[model samples]
Target: MLKSLPMLLLAILITSIVGIIIISIYQIYVSTVKQNKFNVIKDASITVIDRCGSILPYWLPLLEGLQNFGQQILPDYPFSLMSLYKKTLMPFVIVYVTNPAWAFIIFFILYYLFVRPKSPIPNRPFIRFNVLQSILLFLINSLLGATFRALPIEFRTSLYGLMVCNTLFWFVLLTIIYSVIKSIQGKYAKIPVISQAVRIQIDNQS
Candidate 1:
C-alpha cells in the first residue's frame, strides 16, 4: 500500500486536471459561441456528419502507425486494444502498412478539397477546421514517431517505451473522440495549443 500511494495520488491528480480542463474549455466555448451566434450554424446534424468525416482519413494512418510502432516492442496480450484492432481491423491496417503513401495522398486530397483558399472549390469553415486539426495531429504523430524511433533499441523495448507508446495512442484516441463529440454537438473542439495554431492558420487562410 505504501509503495502504491504515489501512483494512486498521481492518478487522482491527472483525473482532476483533465476534468478541470474539459470544464474550462466547455465554458469558454459556450461563451464564444454566444458571442458568435450569427456565425454558428443551428443545423448541426449535417455539419456534424461532415465534420466527423474530416478525421477518418487521418485516423486509419494513425492506427496503422501505432500498430507498426508496437510490432516488436509490445508483448502479445490476449485482450488489448491492439489485439482487438488486429482481430477486427487487420485488413485496413495491412493496407495502410503496406502502402504508407496513401496517408500522404489523403492528406493532399483533404487539403485541396477543404483547406485550400481562394480556389474554384467551395470552402467550409467547420469541416475545414476539423480537417486542419486532423492534419496537425497526423504531423505531430509522424514527428513523435520519428523521435521515438531514435531512442536506443534496448530502451525502445523497455517498459518506459511501452508507456510512451501507450500515451501516444491514448492521446490520439481521446483527442479524436473528444473532437468528434464536440462536432456532434455543433461546437469546436479546443485542443489547447493545437486548436490555437489551427485558428491562426485559418485566420491566415481567410
Candidate 2:
C-alpha cells in the first residue's frame, strides 16, 4: 500500500481534474453548438455505456434512437430551453433517476468481478478513477437535492454546479479510458494523466 501511494494520489488528483474539465467541455459544447445537443448527449451516453463491456451493446441502439428522436423534435422547440431540458431531463434526469444507485453498484461489481478478473487492459487506472467519480457525483446530486430547500438562488446555483461537474467528470473519464485502450492496442494515445496512471497501475499490479 505504501508503495502504491503515489499512484493512488495521482489517480485521485487526475480523476478530479479530468472530471472538472469534462463538465466544462459539456457546458461549452451545449452552449456553443446549438444544433448538436442530441448528438452530444448520445455520444456521451454511449461512452459511459461502453465501459460496461459486451452486455451493454444493446443500449447503444436505444441511445441512438433517442438521439434521432431528439433531433427530430428539438428543432421545433426553443434552443436554450431545449438544450437545458435535454441536459437536465434526458441524460441526467431520466436515466439517472430511474437507475439511482445502480451506477455505483454496477461500477464496483464490474470493477472487481469483470474488470479485475479479466484484466482487459492489464491496468485498471480507470477503475479507480471511475469509482471516485461515481461516488463524487452521487454525493453532489444528493447535496443538490437537499439544497433545494434553502435559498432558491443557492439551490439553482448548486444544481448547475452539479451538472457541470457531472458532465465534465464523465467526459474526462471516458476520454481517458478511450485513450488508454487505444494505446494498449498500439494506437497513439494522448491523454497524459490517464496514460501515466495506467503505467503506474500496470506496474504495481504486475
Candidate 3:
C-alpha cells in the first residue's frame, strides 16, 4: 500500500505541475491578446451613428454570401427567417450582383457619401473602415463568382465546385457575421488579410 501511495503521489504531483504550466501559458496569452487586442475598441468616445454606420455595410457581404451559396447551406425549412429572406430579399440581391448599373449606383452613393476623402457629409473612421471593408468583401465575392463562371461547366458542376462554393460561403458568412458582431460592440473586426488591406487602403487615402 505504501508503494502504491508513493506512485499515486508522484502522479498527482506531475499533474499539478503540468496544470500550473498550462494555466501560466494561458494567462500569458490572455494578457497579451485575449481581449481582442488587435481590434479597434470603441467606447463612450465613439458615437452611435458611427457604430450603426459600421453595421449596415456588412449586409452587403452577408447578402452576397446568401445569394451565391445560401441554398446549399440553408435549405427551405418551413417558417425559417432565412427561407423568408431568401424568398423576399434574394431577388434584389441577385439584381445587385448581376446588374452593374444598380450596383454602381450604390457604390457611387457609398463612396461619395461615406468613404471618399472629401465627402459632403462628414464621416467617422470607424464608419469609413467598415464601409470600405464591406466594399472589399463585395468585390472579392464578385470576382470569385466571375472566376467560377469562367471555369468549364463540368468543373462548375463537379464535387470540387461544391467544395469551393461551400468554403467561400463560409468565408463570406463568417467574416461578415464577425464584423457585424464587432460593429455592434463598437469594435473593428480585424480579420486577417482583408482587414489589413482595408486599413492600408484607408491609411493611404487619409
Report clash pairs, candidate 1.
none
In candidate 3, residue 146 scores what lDDT?
70
TM-score between candidate 3 and the true structure: 0.70
Per residue, candidate 3 scores C-alpha lDDT tens digits across 161-183 of 77787788788888887886676
Off by over 4 Å in 2: 1-93, 117-188
Residues 1-206 of candidate 1: C-alpha lDDT, one tens digit per residue:
34434533443355455545554575468559754875644553444345445434445435545654645433454458557766654545555566667667778887887788854455667778888888888788777788888989788778888777767766766776777567555567899999899999999989
Clashes of each: 0, 3, 0
TM-score of each prediction: 0.69, 0.34, 0.70
RMSD of each: 13.0, 16.0, 18.7
Per-residue CA lDDT of model 2 for 1-206, tens digit only, reads 24434533444355455444554564566557843645533333323222322212112222222332333344446889677857643653244335535444544654564335355554434344343333333344345334433436553347575454345434433653554343222233444554455445445655
Residue 199: error of model 1 in Å? 0.6
Which whole-number lDDT from 0 to 100 does residue 95 have in model 1? Answer: 55
| Cα-lDDT of candidate 3 | 0.69
Q: Which pairs clash in model 2?
A: 19-169, 22-168, 23-168
The lDDT of each candidate is 0.65, 0.41, 0.69
